[model samples]
Target: MEQFEAFLAAHLPSAASFHPHYETSLHQMLLGGGKRFRPALLLGVVQAYNTLLVPSAYHAALAIELLHTYSLIHDDLPAMDNADLRRGMPTLHKMYNEVSAILAGDALNTYAFEVLSNAPFSDKVIVKLVRSLAHNGGVEGMVLGQAIDCHFENQRLELEQVKMLHIHKTGKLIAASLQMGAYIVGRDDLAQQLYDFGIDLGLLFQIQDDILDVTQDETQAGKTTNNDEAKNSFVTLLGYERAMDEANALAEKVTRQMMSFDENLQRELSPTLTQYINRHKD
Candidate 1:
């Protein structure tokens, strides 16, 4: 966690620079706090590939974080999820106003590329990272998921459609982060395996989130609870028990995939995966 903190600090824009006010609110919103799950996932992938090159892993990890932060900022906007609290703090829009939130999200989105360009790796690795981030973070991935989510809100959606929504909105970026770590270590096979693992892991994460929203407290969830029934969500279509069963099955599959790796990597990720699955707002 200290390493993750250092990575965030290293990539954060300094306050001493001009235009600080413009960037300040959004930066503070980001720095306020979250679980930092994405960066840790990237780091885990790197560790699995090989324990060397921790600094490169940190850079890639930071890039994933930036992209994630961007998504959160935009997701909280009035036109989107209209979220008020995020990660237990006032959202970017609530803290800095909608325009500032939009700009902040835009800045973070672009900065992710900048961070990738600055990574202490070969140009080949940098290019691969850039391409993967763009593909996963752009229209083909998160953006498409958001579009689908908005389009289906207040409308009934099939289970497959809901799964597709999560795959685009959440799974793609998770897979990309793991793949980036693999690229850094030159392990294509591990990258592919990790990518597949991430897809299942991400879907499980989303379903668990849906479960929490229905069963947990807003404070623990860091946002509004029971919003899924209002918006199109897997829980709405599949019901709570079925969603739980699916999430558990998916988690088991993810754990099985992790087990295929050496014991060390599986052990490292076990706590991470368990915490996510069992997290509660009670």
Candidate 2:
């Protein structure tokens, strides 16, 4: 994680020369600090396959983090979730202006591809990574999920429908993160298994997020609480206890699947995956 941070600190565009405010906004949001869950998942998969991190893997990790940060910025805009806080700080649109926030997000989104395209991997590997990321982060994945979410505002979604929404919105990119890692290490054979694990992990993560929205305060959650009141969420649709049960069930299933992997792989990944699942418990 420190290495990933250092890599981003060095590579992130400097706001000093051009649009310092815009660049600073980007840096603030990107460096504001979250769990770095997505990149960790990517790097963890690579480390599991090969005991060391590769240059291409680091590039891929940065790409994922950039894309994730972009999503957060946009998701907080007035036109979207109208969120005011992220990572326990004022959101981009709130800190800077909406225009800055939007342009910064756009820059991050495009720059992610640039980083991936210029990775130190072979052309074939880079192409696969780019394709996976585009598919997962673009219309076929997160965007589709966001569209569904916005379209269904104030409309109740069934449990299965909610699962589908999250699978696209929150799960696909996460699944792609694991898949990208497997590709980096030439472990495409593990792609399906890793993606499946990511599905459960993503769902668990979202469910816990939902739980936190209702239970934790801003200080503990590091973001606005009760923000999902108007949105379709696990806690909103299923009630607190049922949502928690679902999360626990998913966690159990994911843990079992992780155990099915080689012991070394399980040891490498369980800690990070466990922290993701148990975050709400804190």
Candidate 3:
């Protein structure tokens, strides 16, 4: 874990040059940290197929993590979710101020693509990486999902609507992580299965998050909890029991897909994935 954290820190942009404060704001937010789940997932997918880790693999993983961090930073803004905490610390906006947080998010979001484009990989692989990321993180995916969330905030949503929202906001990036890994390794068959697997895994993750919001502590979650009651969420639409049931079922179903892969891969990835699903922030 320390090695991985160091690996990412080494690749992350330095808080230097023209806008000193903007760079500092982004560094603080990105460096403040979370589970680094997306990057680890990307590495996991790569490991499942390749015997050796390529240098580009780490770069690709860092890019996804940067994008994820960008979303979290902005999500905590007053204009967005108005979150006060993130990763168990005062939010970027709260620590740095609103303008810095917004600029930091924007910088990280764009810098993610820059990292992807500049990664030390073949042109073909680079193209695939950029295309896969843009499709998943762009208007049709995460962005669209966030739009739905903002539009439907504080309103009761149908079950399908809630599912769609989570899929776009969380699932797309998870799926993209898998896809990016496959692109890096030049593997297509496993990529397709892993992509599908990631979608189910992501859905389970979001449901678990909703469950945590109701059942977990804000301190443990490192962010606001119980926001689902005031926003469009699966728990609000499906109720606690049913939402939990769905999360369990999805985890089981996705884990079953592991049969298509080796026992070793399944054995290593399944427990971590399940732990994430079953987690209670409290």
- TM-scores, all candidates, are 0.94, 0.96, 0.93
Which candidate tops TM-score? Answer: 2
Give Cα-based local distance difference scores for all models. Answer: 0.80, 0.87, 0.80
Model 3 C-alpha lDDT per residue in residues 115-179, reported as the tens digit of each score: 88888888988988888788888788888898899988878888888889989999999999988
The per-prediction CA RMSD against the true structure, in angstroms, equals 1.9, 1.3, 1.9
Q: Candidate 3's error at 238, in angstroms?
A: 1.8
Output the better candidate (1/2) by TM-score: 2
Query: What lDDT is reached at residue 59 by model 1?
Result: 79
Q: Which has the greatest lDDT? A: 2
Score candidate 1 by lDDT.
Answer: 0.80
Considering TM-score, where higher is better, how would the candidates rank from best to worst? 2, 1, 3
RMSD of 3: 1.9
Residue 27, candidate 2: how far off, in angstroms? Answer: 1.0
Query: What lDDT score goes with residue 229 in model 3?
Result: 63
